[model samples]
Target: MTAIAIDHDKPDLTGDTETQNDIFLQVFNSGDGALFDRLYRDDAISNFSGEPLTGEARRKFFVEFIGAKPVLEARVTHSYVAGDVALIGVDFSVKGTGPDGQPFTIEGKCTDVLRRVEDGRWLMAVDRPVAAGGLLPE
Candidate 1:
């Protein structure tokens, strides 16, 4: 496992599975779209909007999401690793003001898959959030 990068310019994602979530939070909270993009692979999949999206669709969603400046807090619940692949479960909430200028909060359990790339860095392969049983207070 590599040390976490202090400079956000180029984050080091070679830590253990659990540490990956922490690093993710650090980057996500930074709101740097370009740096956030480095956390995933070229073909990564994300269902941040409750719909599985990849390619341009995913890019668009994230562009708006980062632009929104949402605040995300997450705790890793569990993680499993086998060789180069890792599965991580996280309980999280994203709070922010929507485009309508309404304050909103979304809570969910996220299932993430990460793979150790050729450079020995762990990058997210998949990210899917399962909605919580009840909606957050409006």
Candidate 2:
């Protein structure tokens, strides 16, 4: 996808860290798998289990994962934006029973990079998650 030429003069509050965090919340809360398609570009990349995903593969991952979860929530800790790139540091906790009725909870820290597209739409360019303070090793 072509990158948008950001207007540096005007502060991009929309693509700032807070806005990125909001976008994440909105998509997850909507539970509409298509939301991913709208929020991500065809060539957008993501870090899932150390594997990169692009195009339809990325959308399918979220659809299947979220569909299996009873609930999911993301909280932002800090964020910043530079030109066309927005960086967000977040703390997330997900609680849900798996498809097999196995209950589970995970706490983690996530760093997300959102890029502005040529069409002036912001989409997730990258998402990296690190296990936070909990039973999981960092």
Candidate 3:
């Protein structure tokens, strides 16, 4: 597993930034539906690789992606929160053999927006990836 190096100076906006990041890492490394239930709102929306996702669609996307290529590692390069919105920038890589028997790896950066609900629970509102050397897809 590759070690993800997080910048020590990154602001922990909500005082629970580390906790939230850890939860996200765990959820990605393990295809745990319960984690999804905790981290994403019912109306959560995500854009990845040109696809728009929401609700169950978003949940399934995470589940399937994690299931297929168990995250080898992830690092939060930057993170910030203002008011009820949190933006996290992460660098991650997944290592695994594809169904075609070819080894595949994807290294990319993701900017995830988390919103604090009325109940004070944080849930992902937008999760988008901007691949290195490629245009940001919507």
From the highest TM-score down, the ranking of the candidates is 1, 2, 3
User: 55-86, model 2: which lDDT tens digit per residue?
Assistant: 78887877776656445577778877788887
What C-alpha RMSD separates each model from the true structure? Answer: 4.1, 7.5, 6.6
User: If the candidates were sorted by their lDDT against the true structure, best first, what order would they fall in?
Assistant: 1, 3, 2
With a 3 Å backbone cut-off (N, CA, C), the pairs that clash in candidate 1 are: none
- By lDDT, the best candidate is 1
Best by TM-score: 1
In candidate 2, the residue pairs with backbone N, CA or C atoms under 3 Å apart (3 or more residues apart, or in different chains) clash, namely none
**C-alpha displacement of 74 in model 1, angstroms?**
0.5
Error of 3 at 81 (Å): 1.6
**In model 3, what lDDT does residue 37 have?**
42
Model 3 scores what on Cα lDDT?
A: 0.65
Candidate 2 vs candidate 3, TM-score winner: 2
| lDDT per residue as tens, model 1, 56-102 | 77777777787678888999899888999989899999899989999
What's model 3's lDDT at 20?
65
Candidate 1 least-lDDT 10 residues: 1-10
- Clashes (backbone N, CA, C under 3 Å), per candidate, total 0, 0, 0
